[model samples]
Target: MASVAFGYLPILLFLLVALGLSTAFVVLPMIVSRFTGAHQPNPEKLSEYECGFPAFEDSRAQFDVRFYLVAILFIVFDLEAAFLFPWAVSLDSTGWAGWTGMMVFLAELGLGLAYAWKKGALEWE
Candidate 1:
């Protein structure tokens, strides 16, 4: 058991060194920047501006529903594609099980798209 434990000593040492180096890399820059950087503050420095337009607006202003609909659709499709990556990588080994699983997943995504379309979520007018 002692020999087995000794065999892993190098790996344990490497992990500790790696962790220490990573921490130092992150901390050193932060410490240096804090000491050397300018500590200046002004009202205009914090204001948000885009193309010379005032960026802030009334907090209670109503937003167009289409914007939210498009965002939701984007998230749904993006997640669906995210799942496809792992399935694609193991395609050769997964055989029919993977194919059927992906088919089901695609079918569900298609249903969601269809629902969104029928509900006028896709219409921009």
Candidate 2:
């Protein structure tokens, strides 16, 4: 109804104000920096900042796939733990159905881990 739509007016106004403030923050800095920022381009300033370490080699270096494999595995296990939190919280209300479902989920994760292990996904070298 008309009254229901009117109820959302405050939220709409708040959204507009939030958008305006965000735009002001982004634009104000750009404007200020454009006018007052210095334009010095010396060799030291242009050089890469590598924790006070001078450039020893090219920056375009290839990383090992072992790092990516470990990272992906960590994310998969991390998400499994994240899903377990809410399931544990409502375990009493969900009864046996919830317990069985969680068991199946864990079994699936175990299988995946086993598969990865068999494929040498967990190996560092």
Candidate 2 TM-score, C-alpha based: 0.60
lDDT of 2 by residue, 28-64 (tens): 8888866886544679887778677777777778778
lDDT of each: 0.91, 0.92
Query: Which residue pairs collide, candidate 2?
Result: none
Please list the residue runs of candidate 2 whose C-alpha ends up more than 4 Å from where it truly belongs after superposition.
Answer: 1-16, 27-63
Error of 1 at 51 (Å): 8.4
**TM-score of every candidate:** 0.60, 0.60
Give the per-residue Cα lDDT of candidate 2 at 99: 99
Model 1 stretches astray by more than 4 angstroms = 1-37, 49-52
The deviation in Å at residue 120 for candidate 2 is 0.8
Worst 10 residues of 1 by lDDT: 38-47
Report the error of model 2 at residue 105, Å: 0.4
